[model samples]
Target chain A: MDDRLVTAGLHEPGLAVHVEDLTVSYHSKPVLWDIDFDIPPGVMAAIVGPNGAGKSTLIKSILDLVRPTAGHVTIHGLPYRDQRRKVGYVPQRSSVDWDFPTTALDVVTMGLYGQLGWLRRPGRKDKDRARAALARVGMEDYADRQISQLSGGQQQRVFIARALVQEADVYFLDEPMAGVDATTERTIVKILHGLRDAGKTVIVVHHDLQTVRTYFDWLVMLNVRVIAQGPVAETYTAENLRRAYGGQIALLDSAATLTPVD
Target chain B: MLDILSDFTLQNVMIGATLLGIISGVLGTFAVLRKQSLLGDTLSHAALPGICIGFLVAGTRSLPFILTGALLAGAAAALVVVFLTRTTRLKTDASLGIALSVFFALGIVLLTMIQNQGNAAQGGLDSFLFGQAAAILRSDLYVMGAITLTAVALVTGLWKEFKLISFDPSYARTLGLPVLALEVLLTTMIALAVVVGLQMVGVILMAAMIIAPAVAARQWTNKLGVMAALSALFGVVSGLVGSVISASATGLSTGPLIVLAASVIVVTSLVFAPETGLLPTALRVRRDKFSLKSRLVLGTIYRLAAEHGDPAYPAEQAMIDAFHRTDTSAVLSRLEQRGLVRSTAHHPEPTPHWVLTPKGLEQAQTPLDQSGETQ
Candidate 1:
């Protein structure tokens, strides 16, 4: 696994996530086969892929939400199970029922549940922290509102706030900008960048090729397996994209448009 | 009713039924909202064989022994449903159906064998199938109270965990919650609830006690805590009403009566509850549609008047109909009532001409402005 990480060109000492020989199969069909990658610490990375490209499966596998058929995931040189407190996840907005009878503040406070452990309820301190996270996402005013009453953007922001309150070293966001408004996308991007600036790693499973360069500094282009990965400047080229998207050059064209002209 | 209440056995039946109602209502909220009501049905049916096994083991009619057997059987049935859904290609509905039928069939066979044994203790074993609330004893009340208190305490203690798991199990798992354990624990809780309800509502009707109140409560509130509380209240009320009604008539048993009472609450809540009730929601939709049509008509006229540089330019009825693609006379009349639009007789032709009032113009454009800003 160390050799695989080195061969993948990751020579960094502080790594946020190290996934090696990760192969996940669903009902005998392999979704992610021998997926290997090591993301350096404190970098905003995007797991870019087309639809049904195992982007979500990869994140779930890393978090041990889905057991892998083979291989293991590590966070900062330790297994994910041992380092769960150091990790946070923002699942896709559609992953949960929005009409669930919970307020925005209640949803945000769920981040602290991992720390609070079983049977102990969240206290005033946890609530204040949740409030701060909500304020960070510009959703403090919506804390008391039922989650279903919030708009799509506000709901997405609330989800981000929930992840924010975890105060983990590595944040994994699955399709954070999938169906949000432009303002929400910008706000989320700013929050991600803020996490990176604060010396935390933010790994996002992103689909919008147009925002990849703008929102992410590191890149993991995957389609069933790792097609190419490294700094966005060197690896986000047309060739790597063509290999990842296969027969979808229109996506490449839009991606190229997002690249700033020097 | 007074005479029946004075009887100690009937009094015990009432207390036991009410406690059953309370527990079922509390846990049923989770079952209903989580789309696991089918599991409740499966578990209740599955408790039958457990009752026979308990009778066979104890060689006597012991409330604790029989209910313990029922709880175990119900939990095993729930586990089987979970196992089939998770480990096989079978879906939840199919698994639930399979478990419910198989366990119920096994229970019936065992019950018949027990009946054929000619044991006096087994005379009322069949009562657990359809419930004989009149057979409830003081000891049964103690079991019901203990189970109810335990369920309430567990629910209160693990409130957040249960809520999170119900809403999003995957996310809860990601947060390092024992999702599987929590789920199994919840299944056990439901089984316990079903066990306590068996003597009052019967296995056949116990599922209703675990479903109807929660569903009825869902119609009344959108908050989980409030929903659970209201469900408990509904369950208690149904229990009391069913018990009193059954006591009044020698022909009636408390099980079906309790179910009927709960079903009535569900029906009443579905039809008339303030927020998500069918009537209010339908009315809101109708009102919104009417207002939307009125705004569209007013906007069309305002646009026409703007084009012609006159606030009072009467919009042609033909144009309004074409724009709305529906009858606009009713909306125009409604608008007239609100002083947003009025019929103008400035034209010589008999065609009704409608013009937007200043208030109507503002009203039409207000929503448009808000929609624009929102988009």
Candidate 2:
């Protein structure tokens, strides 16, 4: 890591992402309770947990889309809103209807929309950047293709490409590969790893155990509570797997949920 | 025919048809993709009160005021949908029904109230109940054209944003899209299309104007761009034909005629188009059935040959007894025609037995792995 990257980790270590005594409630029920953690800048981390683990809630609370009942979340010593553009988010597949009219390339162009603010059109340079992003995901051929025609893996790649086009420092994806085939799953993992290599912070809400050790540098075990958050080498363990996947239903179901974040 | 183009009235009607076609096609694309076909209906019905109110309040036959009211009320309907989805436990269907019924009934009551006053403005307002394409003045046509052009430009220009949010909203958000704002913009666009179309098709026919072309085009193409363009063409053609037919006779309502033309296109597309069409798909299914029987017979022959290390299996009696689970007559007849098996009425086991020739063996060997994957 360069001095800039190193200095970023130290001087803003406390400023990185300070969740001071954060608690979140939904419909009168506490989903995330009094959580405190510091996320160093420019590191990829996986938030792993069982169903209803409040993994997505923690992220939404940080984004201010969800209100925290107690405490506050800050980014680089600034309020989340102050650094809103710096953070990019990817939701699970079910978040939007696929039959929507836009093509894959059109979707990637939306990354520039944040900076464009509103009502202002994307210029030639913006179009070039969108095309470049599509090429990066090897989806340039399908750029003009309707999103519905693409398979699960192809769709996920298009989404990741859109996030990359944002040029934001922080990226968050929620259950990106819930029902993708193996090849696509592998390609997505490789791309996410590449993002981390490029000195960006990547946080994924993941359920798989196998890929955590190899794919993620940092791991967060959440089960309506923060089970652990640290280096995968130290935090991801057999005990943690059991802790995360409580009340085992069956091997296949657990394995399906256990799809690695990479 | 060439001189008709020179005629101002004919020119205005033609221009009106083209504008309505383009607007409905563009908006209806989103409607169909979103599975909100009924939403188009709801907005159209809701526009009636807006048109009536515009007439009563303004006390003039101004297109702008009537359309403005329609646009605002259409947005109100969209907001109601959003509110129902966000705040209440009531489903979208129930809320749409409520909005459609309440707004339409209020519009009827308002229309009646305005009628009781017996004002001249109400004369034009009644025309809005069912669209009067002939009543579309040159000024009204230009306004409609501008809105149509705006819709076309926005949809094509911001194709990326529209696509990302519609296909996969969550992913669009991660890339920093303002999901809520974009959603509102799309709904507003749909409303604007309805507003622009209200004059040409009338409020009652406006919903079909958006939906019919879209439905017809979907039967022809899967790609959004192609579907949108085809839908626009279908709409323009239907509008033009309906207008011509209505002009040909007395007591002919252009709205119903236009809808009938669009419906005819829809029916033809459903039955004839290659992909999702009924006729082609049925033929394809039949072809597949024949191929499936052939494959099954080939499989049995190869399996029997492999088991016995012989080219032939026992006669038809043995086949009927062994593979009685399925109807084996087709397989037997097919094998005999291919000259891959031999059976005749000559011996004690008189039925010719099934066998695999070299060609049959080759055919069966391939695609078994493929079959497993498919199954």
For residues B1-375, write the lDDT of model 1, one tens digit per residue. Answer: 577789887788778877988899999999987898988999999999999899899999887788889988988888788789888999999999999999999999999998888888777788887898888778768878998999999999999999999988887887889998988888888998988888888899899999999999988787999999999999999999998888887798889999999999999999999887889889888887887777777889989999999888888887899887878889889889989888886647778888888877777668564743211
Every candidate's fraction of true contacts kept comes to 0.74, 0.38
Error of 2 at B169 (Å): 3.7
lDDT of 1 by residue, A50-112 (tens): 887899999999988888999988888777776788888999999888878889999999888
lDDT of 1 at A215: 78
Candidate 1 chain B lDDT trough over 10 residues, lowest sum? B366-375
Residue pairs in collision within model 2: A89-B174, A96-B169, A102-B163, A106-B160, A189-A262, A208-A258, A208-A259, B131-B201, B131-B202, B343-B352
TM-score of each: 0.88, 0.79
Question: So what's the TM-score on candidate 2?
Answer: 0.79
Worst 10 residues of 2 chain A by lDDT: A4-13
The per-prediction tally of clashing pairs is 0, 10
Say which candidate scores most in TM-score.
1
